[model samples]
Target: MPVVLSLNVARKTIPVDYARAGATGIDKRPVDGPLRVSPTEAKGTAGSGVAGDSIGDWTVHGGEYQAVYGYAREDLDWWQSELDVPLSNGQFGENLTTQGIDHTTALVGEHWRIGSALLEVTGPRIPCRTFAEFLGQRGWVKRFTQQARPGAYFRVLEEGLIGPGDEISVVHRPGHDVTVELCFRALTTEAALLPRLLAAGDSVPPEVVELVHKRSVVELDS
Candidate 1:
């Protein structure tokens, strides 16, 4: 019944490292300042058009997904309020900013929209070293991740241009039994409890898939 919406999204001035290596075929142009640019630029293999796979567009995990990162309003407010900052200032490099939803409590496989782009909640972004760099704080990597609700990232099923000021709202919540919160709990408080959660066989990342495979009690496939 609640609607999840994106109020703001701040893409990294430096696109994800993988995106730059032509892995995602997204070119980088120093986001922010006069030279700020989006992550859609491709000047690599796709640039030559010789590669059969058209690597000039954003691809996730070698086409696993196009766009990979998102944030929710609740995460913003909690983090920002603690830091004493405004949510619109663009402190984080996360794209697909959000409003009206608490990503921490959101369920995996949930649906939402930003303009014409539809996104499904795939998983929580495992904090990378880059995220720490963005914060300009030592141990921020550990601190930020500890709070959970690291924000949602998705595999894009539809391709469309997304930018700031786009209104985001929820479309539906899948009837999956396992939820993102459970995954977060597994990753966080119940890290030692992973065997049980993975045994649940819910939505999770590929990296976790292997980890879960070993611990899964029942036959799990997804």
Candidate 2:
């Protein structure tokens, strides 16, 4: 079972006042950093990326040790040692930082328990131009899209307070036959496979599953 060994939220919101931000429509953004947590129920915005009321909740796949999100993994000095770019911190804007989990293989509808906090798997990370502004790179959105390992965004099935060093684990993984990556693609491109993916028709998120149905080129008998 994957579980979180540690979690974190901004000790203080970092500053990201890009000088060219106005030109890019990306300025005065608060960069969340060091969001270590002790594990607790997710309580806050639904789709707004702000975990807690201030931010949002995050979950790991299965219940493996802990889960890791945000730019920490890609930007931290330790991780930077492994990368050529040596990225900066506060890129993920995550409410929770976790360890020991393979989020990519995590299927949708998975539920997790961190300390007393319970979260339900809702969807995948939505890419946009805003993220690219931070990297000063074009196609950053497409790069993430190609990777298809975007972490999961969870909804608070239950609510509670959490701090640093909480044990997080999957409470349940609804026996769905779909992987997180496939879920992402269905929402973006290659939506044609949704029917074959869902197999259950309307069970999956309509925004995702039905998006394909709406665009489906396959002829259906009336």
Candidate 3:
């Protein structure tokens, strides 16, 4: 019985040295909500799926496939112990800080019903310079990539309201072994695993499938 520990939204952008925009909406704060969730108007042009959440970099951050970000509270707790830092909800720029779920192992295309909304897991959150800078950690991107606990990104399947304390139920799961952790590894550290991603079908992002095809050709030529 996974529950939304915190429903977070960034109401405004804040200055940051990492992003091209010179500002970021990664500094999310937990908000009282029954917030509406809907698909972005268009890819790379609109912001977040959550009504009030801001997206600083529209080009890479917000889109149909990455409308909402969910990170498990257990994973954040693990980071807190590893880094000896206090991490509050929304610390990692997640729209939903969840409890009682292991997002790292969640299968791509898995459907979660939260409140009245239905969200389908689309991909993993790739660690960026913005995320590293936000955490003020040295070699954070490489470290995060190596750890491979990248949280899940989701698309709004059925638009509705979501709020803190809402229970999250897995309503559907695609027939595949491609978990978020596997997808992250294939895209980042382990290129050898790219072939394995084929079984995931269209459940994975198109960019990932394209990369897999390109890499396969490169390997064959070599």
Candidate 4:
């Protein structure tokens, strides 16, 4: 059974001089006990958890579609070798550090029952300037994108409490065959995979479908 290895949240944003100057929510710390999870009420909405867990950039961070972010402990282990540094839970800015699950193979629209909350996989985490700044690695965005295992973003279907050690079980999986890794590849490295994304049908969010269509056009034109 997959389990929540750690529950993390950024109580407050940290200021940085890099592209993410004002404050970024990329810094997260593990915490014990149950933490509330809910969809962001509005852009820049904070305080969606029992603690002060909040999203820094409302324009692109927190929302109903990406209420929670999850990463695999296995991936962290792999990065630990590459970065030659001891990485801890939430080091990648994930709300849940999960164990015993292959996030890359996790399908979009798959439902996970964790604690009392129900979550649906929405898409893959696309590497961005904030993530690059957080990691502080040269060409981190491109490097991470090339890695092609961008974890998973989840939408909260049933708001509830979650905590470390909570068991996570798959309640449902959509018929779509598109996995999270495939989506990341389609979005980043391989334009040829864009048309294949539509095979997932409604399982893929409309916004992502739009991106896929745009990519498909560019792939054909190029």
- Model 3: per-residue Cα lDDT over 119-205, one tens digit each: 999889999999998999999999988888899999898999999999999989888898999888888888899888888776676
Ranking by lDDT: 3, 4, 1, 2
Better of 1 and 4 by TM-score: 4
Candidates' C-alpha lDDT = 0.49, 0.47, 0.90, 0.82
Work out the TM-score per prediction.
0.62, 0.63, 0.95, 0.89
Write model 2 residue lDDT over 52-116, tens digit each, in one string. 22221222121111222322232234434533464432345444545566555666666667656
Worst 10 residues of 4 by lDDT: 42-51
lDDT tens per residue, model 4, 1-222: 899999998888887765443788888999996887775453245423334675667666766667788999999999989989898999999999999998899888899999999888878989888887778787989888988879998877887889999999998988878899888888888867877778777656667788877876886899
TM-score of 2: 0.63
The residue pairs that clash in candidate 3, if any, are: none
Which parts of model 3 are misplaced by more than 4 Å? none
Q: List residue ranges in candidate 1 displaced over 4 A.
A: 1-66, 85-90, 192-203, 216-222
The candidate 1 region of ten consecutive residues with least summed lDDT is 44-53
Error of 1 at 87 (Å): 6.1
Error of 3 at 132 (Å): 1.1
Q: Candidate 2, overall lDDT?
A: 0.47
- Error (Å) of candidate 2 at residue 213 is 3.4
